[model samples]
Target: MTQHRKRDKNLGLAELVAIALGGMVGGGIFTILGISVSMIGNLTPIAIIIGGLIASLAAYSYVKLGLYYKDEGATYSFFKRTYPKSHFSAAAIGWFIIFGYISTLALYAYTFSSYAISSTEFANDIQIRKMIAIGVIGIFTLINVLSVKGMGKIEDLMVYTKLVILTIIAVVLIQHGSTSFEGFIGDMAMDAKNSSTLSILIVASITFVAYEGFQLVINAVSEMTNPDKNIPRAIYSAIGLAVLIYVVISMGALFAIPSEDIIKNKEFALAAGAGDVLGKMGTDLVILGAILATSSAISGTVFGSSRQMSVVAKDGYLPKWLAIRKKNIPINSIVGMGVMAAILILIGGLELILEFGSITFLLVSLLMAIANYKLRDKTNSSKVLTTFSILGLAIGGVLILYYEFTAKWEQMLAIVVLYAVLALGAWIYSKKNERAKKIT
Candidate 1:
């Protein structure tokens, strides 16, 4: 009985929400804000809200499918099980989703390092920033490998504490802002008139990456209690909260800082701007919030994505060694993810990593939406919403691609090449799995 109790659910609603929020809020807003403001000016908040709504549509399908499948593998497992005969579908999604998580992991670690040294003399040193980013990944990888419950508790602490810091930073910035509410509204009107619809929509589509972490809750289905109730609860709640947090913080930044300054110091805009308004103290607060935000995100991503990686490896879609687990924890997968993310950071620029992650997740989520739409009856999902999800995600995917093609064809070519490689690897694994099955 004691053993049974010990083996029972280890995560609750709060922890689940934290994991989702941790994943969602991690470097997303910090990384996207300057770009969004650069593209749409004061209209960035509107784009962010639209992005959140699109994310909600994506979440509807994820929540429905999660409850129905209840697989800790979440995205990859759902597709694999839903279409049991399609080895390629399973293998492809497994590869894409794991690499998508790897990209975000690198994004978070890079963002963490960016803010960690934003105020220091080393702020301009790219090499030092990359080293710090890799170091932070190593720290969180160790934390995740140590114990699941400990990771959960640490996540809860970091996520909630960061929320408080972020909220305070928002309020403080708003209070000391140069632009009044009326002036801010005027600027929004002016920017809305000047910005093209496609540009605004493109910004909205780009902001979807910021909303990517809510699905991490679904990946924790095994560890959480009453997943049927908590899955939707934690996911929806986190996304909603994320949308609110992002909007508030963006509004505060717009009010306090000039758009050009934000665009100029895109990497650490908040810290750069806060120093002028809130002085050194305000900058410190912003840096602290960013560090905590990205830290929890790294922890949650490592926790959830490693589990999915293990699940995929166990099914022979990835290297077999990644399947090894110690005490139900995917220790090897966690370490492998850290190493891969570090290598990505070493080789890929920030923009490349960010765009790759956004494109991969959007494509994968679009596929998941289609799967849920097809399995609507079993998942008890709304066909109308599922269809909407499919359309919305499809549109988002296309918009990002269009943006890429028009703005940076070279990056688009690189992304295409990467996809080709991933597809080839997936095909090889699927073929191997088929032959083994036939032999058996």
Candidate 2:
């Protein structure tokens, strides 16, 4: 494909919202919700609520960063320019964050595989699972190879469809589902503090997962009609709806199955949520929602990751070839990112991938809070709310790290190792650049 293929422009508020909703509300929700309740027992809904607040705090930081920098790379470019010494750290972190989407991709691939295998009318064939996964990835890769506009339109449609699907499942569950509260809250072995903290952290992390797509909206800052205003608006709108949906779904899951059942069988998470209410059909619908949601997330990441690559190229951080834009799109970067993402789906384990990505994003969120503080002071604006927004992120980042370090230890360790490797990579890249300069 031609190197830099530009489209008409970036995107607008409507497109941005589609990207956010489409990206964030994916396989994680359907798969993780039941497990969460299983872990915390009856406190699952409260955990989701706690998670939602933390995620929103993080989202607020992104909103300010998007407003201040308004660049193509979103946080990576913004942080790099703001903290030049941390450029490579910025790039490495960016790589990690992309893995969140990569994890989602792997998850969807698995779900598709299961669905394809079960669809065999004659008999239940487990072998077909792998076949379906391979085919879905191949198909998704091809669609990604198309123009960015093609990807965006597909993301918008798929995400909305997923939402519709989720809504239908939810409604059916409400009407037909049955589970009393006392039964919903099962006897989980735990002390008060440990149980409460775990529940809170798990829920918080899951809610954060739901906000994953919001960063994607800002990635297309250059395309927005009024990025400064609309991007923030889009971020808020998408996150708001997501939190609402998650809360309701958590409640539904609690009511659908006994808390002990949720813990014992995680795969039955969504099925339990819809089983009594929507019957077998409702169960299938949630699963379908998960598949569609992952598709949306992958689409968002493909577009956003490529744009970050272009932003770095524009700054001379990487080869200008990567920055090449043809027909208004960075063809080189898009394909490069798509290829990398596809490879990741085949290899990197999801938890490790998510941690690595989360670390980078956490750092970016840290910088964003600082940037907002810097900008607010620099501009001397009266947007009191935005000022507090930055403050919340600063505190939120610390709590997130504490939770991640404790809850995701192995993944966190992997992240630290990867950080060292990326640090070495930046060193090599810099030395080569210095040598090239001396030769001239």
Candidate 3:
């Protein structure tokens, strides 16, 4: 068989940033902010800002690695190329990258389903909610299969939508406050029941989920117009903008809902916050924004992960059949990802998927950090930041993982599944490497 090679032309800066922002600011932030406020009181915004900074540092590292290598594997290729010392580590990073993509596809699939069903009482009448969710995945999957341009346009528009909604709410809360939600932070002075050091850290770890989506840009690097310059600029700009918006929205959410009500009703925290003063219209818009944000997230994830699948296919890790062309794109794997995402949606537990996805990203990020330092190439700016960012991310990851895993035994199973994927990828890569050596 002839060697197959076809690459997506570069996408513009707007498309790149849209992808990053759309992927990062999903439904979790709206919901997670509520949960964070309830637990940390007035410091909910502070906790979110902390998580945002940690996530941004990780984003900065990804930007650097993506620029340095400019390869399709994104973080996977970065680690594998940078550190040849341990093949196991390379495989681990690859597996984790794949896991993060798939898990996000799953996480946001659930979000879309919830929103689609909430539009109609009958939609949730049966187990139909899950079915609806799967249906939404199928549609987006088809879109991706058709063309990459369409997906990029859709993602970019969604990014603007999310920014507008969040911005409006922030303005409302910041300027004219009709309702005094001061009690939301009444516990700010370290009340023993809620202010335990353990609880705050636990909340930060949970908040991390709200902040980890910007790396989606690298997955589309092949389609990006200027990988060397655009990738770095777009990725960093997206992270900076998202961090600012998230902190403001988190603070607004804290001010809108009483801490007690926020804890009691985590479902529509942002809407409630909006409702406190602005009444029904404000709450409704926020809910609508949440729906749009989550939908865009699911769309971006399916689009990006499927592209990664195409990249792995080009590299010969996945079957060459996936690398074959249909309308100048990878149709088979894109549809396959859609099907996988739909199934994951049927699994129907957002919390489980979010934690699993976040942990998976952290694992890959930890590897990238180690790879940067081990490479010891300080002359390169990307590597330099990767070194420091990866280290900071690891400390944060460890703290959060310990806090999260200690409580949920189910998480151990996620880790097990995670490692299993790593082992499998490593074995496959070794086989391929051997075949290549023999051919030479």
lDDT of each: 0.92, 0.62, 0.68
Question: Higher lDDT: candidate 2 or 3?
Answer: 3
Candidate 1 clashes between residue pairs 3 or more apart in a chain or in different chains = none
Winner on TM-score between 2 and 3 is: 3
After the best TM-score superposition of candidate 3, give how far the Cα of residue 154 lies from its true spot, in angstroms. Answer: 2.1
TM-score of 2: 0.82
Highest TM-score: give the candidate number: 1
Q: Name the weakest run of 10 consecutive residues (lDDT summed) in model 1.
A: 1-10
Write model 2 residue lDDT over 58-78, tens digit each, in one string.
676677666766677777666
Whole-structure CA lDDT of model 1:
0.92
TM-score per candidate = 0.98, 0.82, 0.86
For every model in order, what is the number of clashing pairs?
A: 0, 17, 6
- Model 1: residues with Cα > 4 Å off, grouped in runs: 1-6
lDDT of 3 by residue, 284-367 (tens): 777677777877877777767666666665655566676665765668777767776666666636667777776777667677
